[model samples]
Target: MNLAKNRNEIDPKFKWDIEKIYADTETWNKEFQEIKTLAPKLKEYEGKLNNAETLYEFLQLEEKVSRKLYLLLIYAFLKSDEDTTQNQYQALKSKIQAFAAEFGSYVSFMNPELLSLPEGTMEKFLEEKEELKLYKFMIEDLLRNKPHVLSQKEEALLASAEDIFGAPQNIYNIFSNADLKFPQITNEEGEKVDFTESSYFKYIISKNRDVRKEAFEALFGTYESFKNTIATSLTASTKKFAFMAKTKKFNSSIEYALSPLNIPVSVYDNLIETINNNLNLLHRYVDVKKKLLGVDELHMYDLYVPVIDVPDMHIEFQEGVDMVKEGIKPLGEEYLNIFQEGIDNRWIDVYENKGKRNGAYSWGSYDTMPYVLLNYNFKYNDVSTLAHEMGHSLHSYYSRKEQPFVYSNYTLFCAEVASTVNECLLINDRISKETDKKKKLYYINEQLEQIRGTVFRQTMFAEFERETHKLIDAGTPLTSEELNDIYYNLNKKYYGDKMVIDDLIKVEWARIPHFYRDFYVYQYSTGYSAAMSFTSAILRDGEEAVERYKGFLKSGGSDYSINILKKAGVDMTTTKPVQDTMDRFKELLDMLEAEL
Candidate 1:
């Protein structure tokens, strides 16, 4: 049997080029020291930003410091993620994080001071200094948050507490990724294999019911032992958001979280309301799964198993890249060229190794190539994840290439759109070309599951998050039992009476890392809805739609997420996108039902 390899055992070609950011730790340390001194220079411009030249000088100096600081932080984080157990890189990460807090405190006065400027003063400064015109949008955004800008001293106090605010997430990460352990389980061949967080999904989708049930029980049961500890960590994290929201004078934590990107609370409400209205469709899909699997009871462990049998197909990393290239050809030559460049330059770290971080993400700084991290297990889902993460990388690639440092990063509200669009395109390409009936049914099933997971499942998590935060706001304690009850009930509601709603599934909420980010999962649902809209348009209008979609990719945070998506042709404020996604889910369900 194949076992997980050590990081050194993996081929160098499969790993991302970390040295591209910094040659060595010595070089990183030297720059770290240099950046520490530059923050003082920023503090020097505190009271003197009223004048045009001084403000311009301050902005330039701040940008220089910020850019360098972000580069340092990125290097530290990448190194730490490469091996979570390595104390040297972990210490390096901690040092950078602490300094980042210090840096935030040092510059915290800038916003309050800038907001204090006389009306039209910033516009006059833009006219006075040609270089300051580049920062006009950023300045306008800052002024837009004037009501929330605290006094200089109060801002400094909050900024200095950044590390404290981040402790819950840090603790949870170390505990889950580096410390947690699972017992060995027997596979279908009666061979004992290690049941790990990275391999749990592999077993949970096994053809053998016993293997799936054992894997499910072992994974969540391990989490159950430490459920209370995780509950405390999650509660502290939620309360932090509540405190910060009330301190900033927002109506609630959700409003506070969404306000930064100019997203209205109505968007969040619309997602839950629309999904609730369409819960019958999900129930219908669940009923179909139960009937197709020919099971007496469909439990949580049975949800992910493929309904139809297909030959086992293992997708090699290069094979997956070639498939993605073909799948995304509709985006035209330029987009494919950039995508190919990333593959050639080793912008991805493929294959799982012991001690590496679990799951996947796309990360980099303004100065570095957008890099992807994955635990590639030779599954088709890994291939799809390749398309998903590269979607993020290319989005970052385009945004950083086109926008300045200030607006280079897009908001989380629109972050999932580009990635989901890639998945939709890839699955559509496969379904369009596959000639075999079983294979066609498989692709259709895959797309349906993607919608169920990204749209329906994530919306459930969104509702769970909203409900928990509301409890915290009402001064109610969120205990282990409370979190479990909330999560278990939502599963019952979303899955309907068709699913068994297993007892062990209650601990599932503790396993979600996104809970630390506060109200982030909802965007996955909304973004997937918007991506379906774009995918349909591209399929229909050809180059006209592709060009508009590319324009949306190039647009970073220069405008609000809603405005940017609107320019790209979808208006997310209404129920249209959600309705479109529901319609697609039903259409696929009909196709699968007929084929079966």
Candidate 2:
């Protein structure tokens, strides 16, 4: 658990090869200027998209310029996240962000202009030039969103306001990652350690109750002190969603957020409804947690502590990678090859460092290898995170290989499916192979926690987002008090009477980064449910299911996320998948409780 205090102190091999995107910042700067020069050319084709030849040429040039722009943008983003405290990389990130906004404004006319073409004009263009066929799905999707497409002038105005719209999220990232500080806390070994956002997970899961309590209070206590400031940023972000949704003629911010992926509002509704019906299962889980911990009262800090301890189980990073590769063997050799390639090529940045961004994510452009960032702490959960993010990376790899740039990026709704599938497989593999009763119980507990954290916890978040957005849509200001009350109540309902919902946990919403991304967290719940279905199928049906699952990953954004998953045999449009997940949860709970 030795952490690097500076980025330079970390082993180079453990870092992602960002040089694959750009050899140096000077090269990034050169391409940045090139894109700036080429972006203005997009304006030349405005009001002329009705002609088939002109439309095809415009799309080609636009794609070429955009590919370069994203490459530069991704480079800057990776550089900035490496150390948020570095002003040079921060400036580099800012430059690309501003240019990207300008680029968005430049291409703003294309959608509106395409929509304004004569009825049957796009069909005629597609029939005339074979090249335009490549953009058929792109054009059709645009037509589907015709009601939401604003005028060229209006679209340009919104596009120009991209940076302004992004300010709240940007402010939150800087404030949390760079400016905010957590007080030092003593570990289980009586060593005073720097408590950080990344290390908070480590401390909260400490075997020592006092250590866990101290870290929990220290973390939330700091957030509580700045609750008003974080509340302002969150409120502003919600208002931004409301404004855009209203401007775009949507019924609500959730509709606006889901529309891009063509997700039905029912999908979001169904998740909340289904999970609400299953609250008893979560309450039972809380009861089990209380009993297993042998506590008179279970608090928020006690939730993450492992009730079944396997003290000797420490997974080094490479061992975790090996376990992941072994766990995913059901996917066959090709998937394993690609996973190993990512490892050999240094596509992952492993370990925490000073000023590093908290949590883990997989990101890359179509032209580059999918890269992952992690704050690896040698815990079993960190191992699962490695498997989860590599799941995303491999999905991106397959999608980019199989589809064109336009369709390479999958929707967020489908994004978590691949990641969660890997996690489910890895945990199940661990559980199946372990002979020791205590270790097996530990894995079972991990699986149960996964369900609780993913399906139950995230659905709670989705509900919170729904409640807050409704307030904004109704012209109600989201003050800190209102937000805190809403979150605290949801915790009580979800966790039930078995556990104590601490007042400090009320300020917890202020610390969630996903709150800034409107209507996004719900997918984690749906995705996990879908993954449970997929994992069950793959393990039960064997290669037939694996092929279908891989096909879904390769399909990417070419179809609606729901349809893609439907083709893969799990239909997210209904509540069956969610119900199936709950059934599995109950089975796991039954097993864990019997063992206890």
lDDT of each: 0.91, 0.91
Estimate, for each residue in 179-293, the C-alpha lDDT of model 1 and write its tens digit. 9999999999999998899899999899999999999999999999999999999999999999999999998999999998889899999989999999999999999999998
Off by over 4 Å in 1: 1-39, 70-102, 118-120, 156-203, 210-240, 349-360, 373-378, 471-486, 503-513
Q: What lDDT does model 1 reach?
A: 0.91
Query: What is the clash count for each candidate, in the order shown?
Result: 0, 0
For all predicted structures, in order, the TM-scores are 0.85, 0.85
Shift of residue 273 alpha carbon in model 2, Å: 1.4
Query: How many angstroms is residue 539 displaced in model 1 relative to the true structure, after the best TM-score fit?
Result: 1.0
